[model samples]
Target: MANMNTLAPHVSGSTFGQVIIDTIADLRDRRAQRAVYRRVYNELSAMGPRELADIGISRNNIAEIAKQSAYGL
Candidate 1:
């Protein structure tokens, strides 16, 4: 396996601006994923118990399903 520690950029060659940009990009991606999950969860929660059961989804399974659907699993 490759050693990731050795891949770290040296301080002399690193750019703080790039690091900040990367962090912001990651945060945006995470926010988008959470938004999708929340939407799915809300839709599922709005369904009646019988309706959810007909679709093979239970109230107890909403969280797991939301996560899997959000991440395209």
Candidate 2:
């Protein structure tokens, strides 16, 4: 029979536990980014057209602007 240790992946190198942890951390990061996007969108949307234009953003661009603000791109 094959070696039992080699039959299953060595957790020390390619850890199943680490994969779970990475997945959870990725989910949390995505959630936090969404929250930030929502907050900026709401704050911008709350402003009047005149207010938005004065800041050089139009109402139609609120979503794009919020995304740029949250993602810095």
Global lDDT of each model?
0.86, 0.84
Superposition TM-score, candidate 2 onto the true structure: 0.77
Tell me which residue pairs clash in candidate 1. Answer: none
Write one digit per residue (lDDT tens) for candidate 2, span 1-73: 6755553354556576686787789789989988999999999999998898899988999999889978877
Candidate 1 residue spans exceeding 4 A from truth: 1-13
Task: Give one digit per residue, the lDDT tens place, for model 1 in 15-57.
Answer: 7787667778979999999999999999999999999999999
Which pairs of residues have clashing backbones in candidate 2?
A: none
**How well does candidate 2 score on lDDT at residue 58?**
83
For model 2, the run of ten residues with the poorest summed lDDT? 3-12
lDDT of 2: 0.84
Residue-level error in angstroms, candidate 1, position 15: 1.0
**What's the true lDDT of residue 1 in model 2?**
65
